[model samples]
Target: MALLHRAELRPSKLELLAGWLPGRQWFAGEAGAPVSRVAAYRFDDPAGEVGVETLLVRAGDGPVLQVPLTYRGAPLAGADEHLVGVIEHSVLGRRWAYDACGDPVYPPLLAAAVLADAGQAEEYFEVDGKREARPASMTLTGSRTGRPVPTGPVSAGPGDDGVTVVRVGDVELAVVRRPVPADVPAAGGLAGTWPGQDEPVLLAYAR
Candidate 1:
């Protein structure tokens, strides 16, 4: 696939945040909450459609949460709607931003992040690399319980109907075919007692 050109993006990262942050599960702002730029930065991406951002927002109370989100076009089915947002990239112009769990370029990007701690020789990438795509998966080891997470289907391999984990030394990158939703709690209260009750009412991402 052809990559997007960088010359098409805008210069303001804050402007990107202004439209991006509210749609995150970790965001603690009120509905349509006004975000006063606390701090922010962008990530490098080989593919222009994907935009990564680290944002700090002082919402209601406690210190700002450093939210790292990978934005791209469209929402991952069944994900919290907050994960999707349209931002004008300094290079790719207007594009959606969300998690990189399902993106093809993520394997390489992920490899870079993991290799920083695990060493490049120990990093790996997984993809289909064909006309048809299969699901993608990832395993985060720092977590207390080290387990694999199948991120769902990705592009199939060159001539195969399935995907492959291009291994690196002892490290193996397996595409998580199915992602488990984080244990989340439903919103409480009948109606009037809820906070931010007077906003563009929708389901809140509560854990």
Candidate 2:
């Protein structure tokens, strides 16, 4: 389960993304275009230390983009290159957010989810020191695979179109960074559904 706190965020998530997204090499939006978040999903950190969330966003009428982020209480060691920015949370104090593609904690968790056919983590909110269930904004379904969970840090390789190859341990996972036609199918992969979407959208494939 993913726990959320009712808190104010400095600079806000969208505000930060507006400044960061345009700089990405794969960004298809016009420079400085306003970006809006369409939907999001979260993955549980087994240790409950890091916050892992994936945001689906669009800038103006540009293509939908998938950006996964990891939030940490302190800076992740040797992850300066992946740092998104530092933000202050009204309840959790300061947090350091990084792009999950470069964070060591993300790929292994993703691999475990895909291998286990796990769903997105359920979310809860903290109120008066008590936990209250909240609706999950997104749902994820992973294709079942009998392979053992992948381990070790993830490595990136050349990709075609908007699909990127991320290696986790000995397994190669293909991540779709851009949204494709709804009818497109994957032989074996991770799929997700968000608010207003009737069909499952492919997110990643395990090879």
> Runs in model 2 with CA error above 4 Å?
182-187
Worst 10 residues of 1 by lDDT: 187-196
Task: Choose the strongest candidate by TM-score.
Answer: 2
- lDDT for each residue of candidate 2 in 1-207, tens digit (9 for 90 to 100): 999988899978878888888887767776688888888888899899999998999877888888889999999898887889998999899999998877777888778766767768888998888999988777778867677887766776546777767788887877778865344234357778877875888787776
Instruction: Note the clash tally of each candidate.
Output: 28, 0
Alpha carbon lDDT at 169, candidate 2: 86
Instruction: Quote the RMSD, in angstroms, for model 1.
Output: 15.8
What is the lDDT, from 0 to 100, of the residue 30 in candidate 2? 62
lDDT of 1 at 153: 34
lDDT of 1 by residue, 1-207 (tens): 222232445534445555655654444555454454444333466545555543445544433444445666665555454344555666444566654443454444333333332211121223344333222112222111122322333331111112123232233343221112222223110001112223211111111
